[model samples]
Target: MASVSSSRSSPIGKLPVDVFDSILSILNEEDRDTLKNCSSVTKQWHDRCVRIIFSSLDINNKNTNAFPAFQTWLSINVDAAAVVKTLRIWKLPVEIDVDQLASVLAPLAGLQNLTLQFIREPQSQIKSSSPLSIQGPRSRSLNTLELLLPSEANRSMLAALTVICLFDTINTVGMQGFSSLKPDLRSTEGLTKVHQLRLQYLPQACASEEMNMFSGIMTSAHLRSLYLECHSPSSWDGLRILSQTFVNLKFVDLDLVQLKNCVKDVDWTTLWKALSSCAQLQRLRINPPSLVDALVTAPSKLFQTSLTSGGCWEVLRELVIGPGYSPRAESLPNRIQRMLWDLPGIVRHDLRGPFPNLDTVTVEVPLSAPMQKRDENGRSNGLAAPTVVSSEQVKSAIVRALPSLQEEGLLRITVIGRT
Candidate 1:
């Protein structure tokens, strides 16, 4: 039993080099302690295990003293910092100085991804340098950056955004919870080619201001994808600005959350009117209530009149509607069919052309109670069920309305709901 126990704990160095590499490659940062134990077994194992352990670093307070401990470890073994490719610093302590954070990040020359979230009370005048410590004229290799803040936008947070944007390698950025956009964000030269931008958690009062800020920062030709998660009707003003500002935009996703003060019936005319300018738009996802409201309130001749005026969405290809609320009207299918058939011509007039590049439509509806099947003896064997419209029925209705879609097989309809 003693011999068996000793053999079971034999040195990791006994394994073949290929086998050792494979074992280390499969283990993530979660297995850091086990990897450290393996590294202590022998010199060869040390190189393999340490590289895997230090490849990505997450610094946060949730683990209790993890950031300080990592700083201490990094100070002792400075070479390990070069192995880091992804760094995440979230929920930092207010007591930690910006200089201290800078010094810790300076060693990561190979870092490619960085996410920073500072939630503590804001401090003024922290003179932060470029987070990446790359030297010489060579551009940074970092590709993605994510900045998350609370609903309030302070001078300190804007300064952080400025410091981060100094890096030329970032091609995509996702920012959330910023209540306003400062003009300083527009001076970022590195954002010229930032093709993808995500703006989330926009509040009602700040919607117009944020749109103005974004319009200033993003040049029309540079931005391609824009996503907005808004909490007010003021989103219409922002969307209008975005449509006119980013003419080359290919994708747009809009999520309008119902705010406490907003009306139950939203008017989508402003949003649709804004969309009229996006001639290059290929993909769009909008809240279902907007479309439902437009059809319910607007006259059918309004669409025909708009078609004659030459306002159409000719380049649109993909559309997605929401997990919707129940509409006020019962003839939803007919209204939807009428809008789908005539929407292309409503925004633009292109009689010689196909009018739309549309290929796919996705609708997410609420599930309804299903009817139960009964058995013999007619003693109420759970056969009664509520009458409900199925997704298939909706699909069939759409196909019937547009028979050309059925013949061409170019249109793909996805209806998601109860079974």
Candidate 2:
């Protein structure tokens, strides 16, 4: 392989053919051959393959006692832990001591991301942050934290907050599919990353707790990029608070899919007011069917007064909107219309500075999901699939809806498929 010295090019693609072949062997599940061949290829390939393979560690002690495997084998300055950047703990044994787990994780000095996924674990809230407050050889700061606590896990919202406060400095945090949290207003200083905070698909149960948690976030001098899914009135008020303190937000993903059922509760006037504070905003994404309707049907006056001529998202360069699916739930379009009737003429006229500095406008077509088929037992797939919507058709519709975007050559269209 004469390609060894070609480091100036793409770091991964520049690998020699033999090295790629070893990687292909692994992808093809020739695991025995892969371990043998990859290690034997070259010292460089050996280290690279090991790093790529173990860069993300998943621990589950319930089935195979995976924690011990890490302690006895991978943690060896065989230095596998040195390459681990993402750590996921699945169903950490309820009886296991946190101190023991902390010691095991001490060797992952390069770890930057942590995910706590509770699967098959008994319902018990973590009592304190001590379990996650590691005094070890690992890096002191984590860049991201994600909690995937589905209903099956009997999710304890308190446990979620406990894990978050452990890191002295964490930049990004995501909590998905949670039901409710017992109210706790105590603040922690760790989440000071002017980067991102995402809370999606949460039920409208704990409005007070939601306000407490998110309002505290609003007070953070370090809070930057935020994506919140709010269905209740109080939570939207939290958005009003965000407007007052959103000093450094650069990117915002506003997914209004959950608004399908609770659109009435939202004060569009308040939402527009909140968006007016993103003085540093560079990207704004208006996502999905119901959200499109919400935007289109909002009173024209809300847009007129909320943003000033001198301020409000003037620096925004990117705008993403739509999937021409009918805004009304009952009429799902099987084929794309000649015009994206759903989008109407809002973005070109209403949204930010009329987006004077807008550079790129992306329009996403609804995913082309094949119609679901029933099995011989009369059971169907989980998704009630829809007819495939062509990207070309969607693009054409978008051009009709916003002719200026096409004329100015700022329009781009996308259709994500079932991967």
Candidate 3:
């Protein structure tokens, strides 16, 4: 009994410190919970793992209290904020206290990315104070900022922009679900080092005021990549801002989902006409930049009329038709066929045909089209399940419609996200 007790109590051969260190170093954010549980294993391990685990702080409705707790803890332990490199807060309508926001962010000297998606409409009556700038060269490490669903660019948004000015490293700034009904434009003035901009989901009837706000704050010459997606046709008119403001633009992505009551509601030529006004573009003819990527949801007839006659798509080096970047946008079957055929004598015009650079038009056809199957009466769009159309039949249909691509051995079909 005495020998048995001694054997059980004695420590087994332990892993060497270097081997244990090697194993712990291999752990990443995916093993965050495991790290949290094992932090007490060693003092050195705790210090190293804590930084890795807390590098990204995501605060949403589920963990609303976590932000405040972190705020309180960071107030006492200033060094703790250094570990956090990214901060995200989503679906929370809490009033953004600008001064408090600055105070919280000031200590996070290494914070590189920040995303705020608040479910609130800015009220005109909400009083605001100038954002207390978090001054420090290290604070400039912030590189990406995504501001979504704020609806209006009020003082809160302005304060956020002010905070952004302290960080010149910020390369991308996204403003989504914003309308033209913003506060006075004079306040949003600042020169940002923004290289990429995303203006998505703007409301109908966008006008000069909303578009002017972006041109006022951002540097036109420095901007390179521009992405615009909205339901409003007038939003294209806003693209005029790029003509003078963003002169150095190299790439443009558009996901315009026009509101069509009937078949003829959308003017097929409107989008191409707007794009014709890009920086180097002339009045009638187009000498657009190298790339113009779009995920247009218009009908095949619209594409047939527009693409052939609209502008010189022959300049396209890369083009993706079906659901390239936007989920809300879709490509119909007939639209792909329209893209394939080059009807030279169909119209009196002889401008568009035989895309020289475009060898393959990569179209991503979602299996959800037939697999999930959309319903007529349901509010929910699609539920991924099974197909009414078989993969073999789909291939056969493609072969019949587009024989040239297959003959050249450039055609390939893939079915994804369905068992």
Candidate-wise lDDT, in order: 0.56, 0.56, 0.50
Model 1: per-residue lDDT, tens digit, 1-419?
00000111223433234434445566676554565477355666677655755677666655435556566656655656777888887775323354555556667888878887766555534344322222334345567778777656454345444434445545677876765534433243435346777877666666465566566556677778888876677666777877778888888887653433353433445556676677788888764333444444553343344344445678887766555344323343543443353543432443223346666655544454233333453232343553455656666665665555456664466545542
Q: Cα lDDT for residue 124, model 1?
A: 32
Model 2 Cα lDDT, one tens digit per residue, 1-419: 11111123222333434544444554545543444566447767767666766676666555535666557654433456687888888765323345555666667778898887654345444434432243433236778888776643333454565455445567788877554554445643344342578877556554455545655533446667788765455556666666666657888877655555455566666776677677788887765434444444542233344443334567889877644334322222322321243334445565435567878888777554344444565454556654443456555655676787677787787775531
Off by over 4 Å in 1: 1-44, 61-72, 93-103, 122-138, 156-160, 181-192, 207-209, 257-269, 290-314, 322-356, 359-390, 415-419
Residue 24 of candidate 3: its Cα lDDT?
49
Query: How far off is residue 156 in model 2, in Å?
Result: 2.7
CA RMSD of all predictions: 8.6, 9.7, 10.8
Question: How many residue pairs in model 3 have overlapping backbones?
Answer: 0
Q: Evaluated with lDDT, which candidate comes out highest? A: 2
- The residue ranges of model 3 lying beyond 4 angstroms of the native Cα positions read 1-42, 58-72, 90-99, 119-139, 152-160, 182-190, 240-244, 256-263, 277-310, 313-315, 323-356, 371-387, 405-419
Candidate 3 least-lDDT 10 residues? 1-10
Pairs of residues at least 3 apart in sequence or in different chains that clash in candidate 3: none
Residue-level lDDT of model 3, residues 248-324, one tens digit each, is 56567765443333223445466555554453321111111111122123323433455444455434444443322
TM-score of every candidate relative to the true structure: 0.67, 0.67, 0.63
Q: How does candidate 1 fare on TM-score?
A: 0.67
